[model samples]
Target: MAESKVLYLQKVKNQNVSHILHKIWEHEAISRIELVQMTHLTSGTITNLTQELISHRLIKESESISDSVGRKRVNLRFDNSYYYIIGIDIGRTSVSVVLSELTGNIVDTVEYGTEGITNPEEVLALIEPYVHKLLGQAESRKRKVIGIGVSIPGPMDQRTGKLINPPGFPGWAGYPIRPTLEERFKTKVFIEDDARTSALAERWYGIGRDGRDLVFVTMGMGIGGGIVQNGRVLHGTNGLYGQIGQMSLMTHGGAGAAISYDCWENLGSIPGILKRWSGNGDFRDFIVQVRAQEPHAVKVMEDTLRMLEASLTSLINLYDPDVIVLGGKLYPYLSPHMEAIVENVRSRVFDFVQERVIIEKAFYGQMQSLMGAVALVFGHVQENPLLVLGAD
Candidate 1:
């Protein structure tokens, strides 16, 4: 058989093994009997799979837990500290790095300001020290580094493992982020668009845990977002799916429905909003001004919310997701007005079905992107258990 075909066949053969591990990890601890029940695999098969994972140190036997009858049962749980995943979030304003265990619990974090630094080599230089620092911390804990995950600005070329003219970072257009990091770390590395990383964060740790469809939006910088449907991030052709900022607004209503190209990002960007709201304050100051009921600040916020209501109405109709999560610098400021925004969207949605869409604030704080990076590696392990098995 051809090499490619052989490799493809090998993946599913161990899918059951990996599935068993996920069940164990998800529940924190479980017994072989529970695994068989959850996975619907035979008791013998569950035994073999659990044994295989144990042999690799991917999971370990937890101490006996007494049941209702006081019978000691051996519970299985992930060897949380046996392996580490490094997550990096490279934002326009700063770079954040974190080391996390198998359970997605962050251990150490490093942050450095970038102030929109886009020079590829300079960016790499800033990241290298933090990466080494976290790796050092992991080694102190006796955890082997398994892989690295990066949440970065996009439009990235996933197939080529390169950045493609990322916004405000044009010079990094052709940088090979994946290969560069893999070479530096001597392990597999994965890069995902920052927005999608938030969606992953939700799927793994936030509201997305309940459902298969999720949309995460960032109101800061520009109106960026990511889509998750059926538990998979959507990377359209050329990896440019989540351009929520550019989603054209329905400027007017009619059969012709006067469409405007003035996207939310352009109209609602930080500079533009502040510029419109008296032109004298940063976002924080603007929030204070709004709280103080300053006319200009109040007016600008109202205007933005009007468009936000329209934008969200359009979003719900178009995507039809189970939930839409909003976060970023602007979201908190909008908290006082969230009820109004939701009510307006509810009243404006196309029909009753679209009105059922649940819009909520982002569950995580600064940890969103960084932890999203952690989710990336955990996702890879689910699909390819060899990361823990020390298989290439």
Candidate 2:
């Protein structure tokens, strides 16, 4: 009983230390005095923890600053070399791997085609060595690879860590991504819906940081969204809260059972548009041509915007987020069409609701999902004492 009590007390102290270290990382450059105030930990405790962190090279003291009152304070900042994280964005056509520091700076990146990833084992084999090589180039050993975060297209089961019948990637359904990656990397791994991961990226490092309640909509091969309320990603009971592409928007409820057009993905997803306009060259390429003032491309652009507007209007009415961020590979083409989308939604939605919601494009662009995966690891480190102490 006495040993158990001692272990519990030690665990509590470790948790506090981790939380304090996270605060320092978030603030970037903070003084010991400020840390004491922010963490409400005694000066003695702060000194001990900060000393341990500095000794481990997890944090370092910046050059001292002399205040007007003849007092000098040392600023503490995260030591970028302390560890590294790997972010993997596995999309339909390709997979992108980024190696970044704890401070969120990219060290190196590699992209490879997924044309041959029909077998799940093959996909893992391709990813594993590339990650190893990237870490080798950085001269970072396995111990320094803190975590691996994966972003994939999904109608996924977050709890079970399974991709549940994702329309975009047919072979990925029920894939045990977390365990597979964990086994390969021999480290902690996280798997999340690409849209939600993109939203997490925005919240942590992009525009949504200013707003507590926000929605991120990705208009790409498939249309999907992620919602952040009160600074937390709201995963529903089945972890599918942001799978908005399935929301029924058409009056006819879409073509037929044989066609699989009932979901919003069939109505507004990029592929859906491509299927609708079979005569068109690539829809994305056509959009670019339209933006450059090609005449035939104009009609395609108009029809795409109208379909997107229907989905946007439904989301705006339902979530009523403070901000709605548009992103994904297709967002560039959609930028010029933003005005039309806003106009359609404004005209359809309740006047009072329309007045409050603001729509904008994602500032981070293609990197949003990748960065969000990093944020997942960072967020986990922030919350877990065992991980934090282990990292230090």
Question: Residue 169: error of model 2 in Å?
Answer: 0.9
For candidate 2, give the lDDT of residue 328: 86
lDDT of 1 at 71: 88
Instruction: Point out the worst 10-residue segment of candidate 2 by lDDT.
Output: 251-260
Clashing pairs for predicted structure model 2, backbone only: none
Task: Write out the backbone clash pairs for model 1.
Answer: none
Could you give candidate 1's per-residue lDDT for residues 224-274 as a string of tens digits? Answer: 889988766888876678788887654443377766557788777676587
What are the runs in model 2 whose C-alpha is more than 4 Å off? 1-11, 18-22, 138-143, 209-211, 251-262, 288-300, 343-356
- Please list the residue runs of candidate 1 whose C-alpha ends up more than 4 Å from where it truly belongs after superposition: 2-9, 63-73, 251-260, 350-356, 390-392
Taking the tens digit of each residue's C-alpha lDDT, what string does model 2 give over 75-135? 9987886688889988887788898887678888878788746666677676789887866
TM-score of 1: 0.88
